[model samples]
Target: MRQTSIKRLYLMEVGSMPEYQIPVVCYLVQTRDGKNILIDTGLPETIPQEEADFENGQDVIQQLSRIGLTPDNIDTVISTHYDIDHAGRHGAFTRAKYVVQQVHHEDALSGNPRYAALRAEWDQPMERIQLVQGDMELFPGLQLLETSGHVPGHQSVLLELPETGKVLLTVDAVPFAEGFTRDAPLNDHNPDPEQARKSTLKLLDLVEHGQVNLVIFGHERAQWDGLKKLPEFYG
Candidate 1:
């Protein structure tokens, strides 16, 4: 008889919006081999009040310790795209290799204030960086799905869990379940509205056809409230 290893998944609550108090989260995937894979690093400990009202709740690295791990435990860091909020805390996982879209990496360093302002987090010197050009499988059963619309290099993640089935972390691709239901555009200060809309529909189609078992949106307050947060493993 042979035995198989089981993987676990958790959602780390990084912070929340000041106004109305919304959640900012990131995914933590613990592989069967004890390897840690981080989806996105949430907000920094503090953000500029002038840009947006927010509170950096818990430290992700600290949070990891609570689960018997540390920043050094992270083996890979995948950024769906480099927006201020999504790329804010990548600096913490210094021991992990960064996997990002080549285009997004370039844009973040291209001096656009939106991303440039958060340069310290993403631009710092690092090695073992993997800049992906398109969708890829980071590992078996864990795949990156490109849904670029809200930004040029946007992507989503899909993980096949033995107990939980198919789980899709939509990040900013869908924004919320509401967008998927109505085929509505994200009122997310998108740079390209047309592209955002088109990409959103593609995601909706995946859900409609039953390709995804569960979908987790980026920063939807209502949806975030109902999810199983960190310290709670999905699979």
Candidate 2:
């Protein structure tokens, strides 16, 4: 068996929503093999505060530079989903191969005006995009969870670190830790509430059976406030 080796996991708060009190987060996962995997890209730099609040040195590129990296240094860019808050800076990393779910990508490109805003960011050259059908291991220690409901093909992450153990990132699948339970009510963001609930239940089961050590929600204000941000990593 291949030994899972992850060096660091950096949580980056690239932007925030004051009205809802949610933090827009992105993760930078560094592997022992020197791979930089960036999961989700926060809002674009040109975004107005009316949509999402952002400050200087908070964009994807700026955040990378803080850790002695650039877009070129990123080996893979994973799209949890193509929401405006999650994929605005995706186009910037032209050198990185993009990973996303097939269903989600099709839905985003299905002539829906809701996703039209950031189509340019995600609709890159086909050669650069790797469409995944279902759950699979992206790397030795990194696993992708297909937890749709928040969107057509929204997915989450299950990452294993040598010291930190298993870390589950339920990105938008269950946006808040308070709502992570089986009986938690679904929010309006879920277009398909039933499917969303099933996804959440699946994740809950994984936590119980898979021995998950840390769980990070999508836009949870309280959780984000307590987590270690970039430069300070969890490994």
Candidate 3:
């Protein structure tokens, strides 16, 4: 199998927000060579003011254990953006090199107001982050699609799965199925709604052109229920 020979994808639900119980999830991607890469992360602790909380059962370590993985097993961590719910758990993957856009790193380090309460979670040592510009190929068949405007440096992941064909992890680029199909970005988190709308259209184009086989949205609880979970993976 090649570097992207139908990787095993695992969804780890780390935590969730209150009321709606919007889940905070992280994805684990294992290439054919057994390289483990993580995508996004849940909150490190919790933000009461923001109404963020972790269920006792949603421990990151425990979630990894479900698939027989440890923090040390991850080789890289990818951040879709600097949002607290998506990137705040950077501290969990202690040994993995973090892969994020250069602009995000700068904004995050400067303590952007969007991440003010979550700033402390971005304390990974400088050496751990590998910053890139624009779109980047992380592996032979894995690509990072920079679809900013939810935040200036946001991105999404795309992979050529052997069986599933093209798998697109929409991340925050499209928060849910409705947003993708309707090109509607939730008002609250879209730093620039105009850009957000355009970026989402790019993703839809991929699907319209029959380039994507599956799409996993960032925090779509409804969609999450219909998809396979850890231990039950897609290749």
Candidate 4:
């Protein structure tokens, strides 16, 4: 298998309400084979007005288009969980194959409100989805690691960078850098706090063992201290 570099794009910044600036970042992992795999899609453009109070004035898709990439260019999409803010704009990547954990699919289909909201995003595009059971290799150097806890099927992607070593694309499993360092219990958004903790510990082990050099969060600020932009690659 060949190695690849990961690039991130700041699609939108949300949660500037009541005094906070939380970014809704979308990652674009370009493979050695030149396929543009999108990690997540930000909030939909037509979010309900009632929900507008928490929204930041930014158009995620438009931002992507400005960088010369459109929804049609995406080939595969991996959703870390079923949160509205994370997976809201899934419809934009209509041409890509949707990937999610099988456990998450069952939970979401069970009518749980949290997962129910995600239905509108994936339900209509069932034909394009590929429900994975556990850890599996998606491409040459890209592997999906099951990191449940934040959500039933919350998972992270591992990319083997030739020069940079390993990089973990951690989603909500650890929302921010502090969460990874402190191993603190996240907010109530996570259904299984204990499981989340376990997942965090597992990540710590990966870091401690030098298996992964960088950990990128779904909603965090920086990708790392130093890394190339989404369109550029290292090694």
Candidate 1 per-residue C-alpha lDDT over 147-186 given as tens digits, one digit per residue, 9 for 90 to 100: 7778888888878777887788889877767777555745
Give the lDDT of residue 211 in candidate 4.
61
Best by TM-score: 2
For residue 224, what is the lDDT in candidate 4?
38
- On the 0 to 100 scale, the lDDT of residue 207 in model 3 is 80
Best by lDDT: 2
Candidate 4 TM-score to native: 0.83
Q: Rate the local accuracy (lDDT) of all candidates.
A: 0.78, 0.88, 0.78, 0.70
Clashing pairs in 3: none
Tens-place lDDT digits, model 4, residues 126-198: 7898999888888766778789988888888877767666777777788777788644755566778788888
Q: After superposition, how far is residue 155 of candidate 4 from its true place, in Å?
A: 1.2
Candidate 2 lDDT tens digits, 186-219: 6766789999999999999999998899999998
TM-score of 3: 0.90
For each candidate, give its TM-score against the true structure: 0.91, 0.95, 0.90, 0.83
Each prediction's number of clashing residue pairs: 0, 0, 0, 1
Off by over 4 Å in 3: 1-6, 53-57, 182-189
**Candidate 1 segments exceeding 4 Å error:** 1-6, 185-188
| Model 2 quality (TM-score) | 0.95
What tens-digit string does per-residue lDDT give for candidate 3 at 1-235? 2346447888777777556756678888888888888888766565545543544237666778887888889888988876767776677788899898898789877867877676666657889889899888988888888898788889999888777778899988887677876536345657788888878888898788856878989888888878888778887
Q: Distance (Å) between predicted and true CA of 145, model 3?
A: 0.7
